[model samples]
Target: MRKIVTVADDADLAHLVDLIDMLPGPDTRSFWGEGSNSIGSKVGHRLREILSGRGDSSDVDYLAIYVLKYLGRGNRHIPEDRITANLRGASGLPAAGHAWVEDATRTAFTLVTRYSLPVWNGAHRTRGSAWLQG
Candidate 1:
């Protein structure tokens, strides 16, 4: 997963929740807890509860990463990316190969970039932090 600087406000977070709600949750039985039965839908709902005039910036930042991990599964239904899997665990084979997954990924990325700060890549530091300078 790419490092992101989350600048999402309540409205942006609300929109993101809407997008997330459209996805089907993971199909694994163990993923469900005592009260919650759906992973994807529960994530969105929980985010909504937090963002509904109650959450702080830290909550938003945390949830932004949470939503990204939830959206980052590959065509194989798992994160495929080692770092992502290590951090968020394998995403099981439920939403894999779905066209909506691509749409959700793009929307999530667009939301993130809309307010993200420019990151200075370590390997490219020789060029100086021109983006920050600007």
Candidate 2:
């Protein structure tokens, strides 16, 4: 496999190079290009790698493919959430007006009640537990 280089500006790149130079091994890396969608999970993982101080961009190609697949996942080019809100409401899920609106309202209420007693504490804690279980 070819080497990889992080995409960064002068100051960040200088620091990166210096850090790499200090590592026990001598290595070089290359970059094919920018972020893409074909590699969504891979890109996410690489992002975690970068954030955690690992140096690798083999995921760039996968990212490019991922971006090409879902060009608007990063941007609301089609205002999909608005459209989804309508569709979800129409789905007849017994929502408070609709699923989207219901979720929005519920989420809003949750925030609004941030100053309230811990009555919702169990529910919120359950949500966290579910996340961990998942």
Candidate 3:
């Protein structure tokens, strides 16, 4: 079985939800829930382009890095050297790979979303996260 890496702690998710709600514009954030749209993939793809020098690094903020590094598999993807090569292959700088690899290495490991799923009959999971915070 594979392990998911989302913030299963209620307190943590609560804090995160509060923080995500504070973002200024609709296009800048991905607040996900029933009606909340989870456009994180767009941000990821855009960031990959900017990281490859294809676009600007405007949204490369601390919070983004924090989530990507700790909660998700950000640092584990694309090596420094491969960035340029991958950029070349991508032909316009999309996410280097659908799955992240051990930076600079051709070998790719499985890269799951790390997002927590509803568990324990939804009691434990729902209690830990609040979609209403946003």
| Predicted structure with the largest TM-score when compared to the true one | 1
Model 2 agreement with the true structure over 57-116: per-residue lDDT tens digits: 433333333322322233333222432433322443334223333333333233224322
What are the root-mean-square deviations of the candidates from the true structure over C-alphas? 9.8, 19.8, 16.1
Q: Could you give the candidate ranking by lDDT, starting with the highest?
A: 1, 2, 3
- Go through the candidates in order and give the clash count of each: 0, 14, 2
Name the weakest run of 10 consecutive residues (lDDT summed) in model 2. Answer: 23-32
TM-score of each: 0.43, 0.26, 0.21
In candidate 1, which residue pairs clash? none
RMSD of 3: 16.1
lDDT of 1 by residue, 12-131 (tens): 666666654444344433332224534444554546546465554444554555556654546332333422323232353334324345555665565555434223245336444566
The worst-scoring run of ten residues by lDDT in candidate 3 lies at 104-113
Instruction: Please provide, for model 3 over 1-134, each residue's C-alpha lDDT reduced to its tens digit, 9 standing for 90 to 100.
Output: 43222223223333443333322233533231122323344434444443444432222232244344423434443232333233323553434432322221111111111122232236355543565566
What TM-score would you give candidate 2 relative to the actual structure?
A: 0.26
Q: What lDDT does each candidate get?
A: 0.47, 0.34, 0.33
TM-score computed on alpha carbons, candidate 3: 0.21
**Global Cα lDDT for candidate 3:** 0.33
Worst 10 residues of 1 by lDDT: 81-90
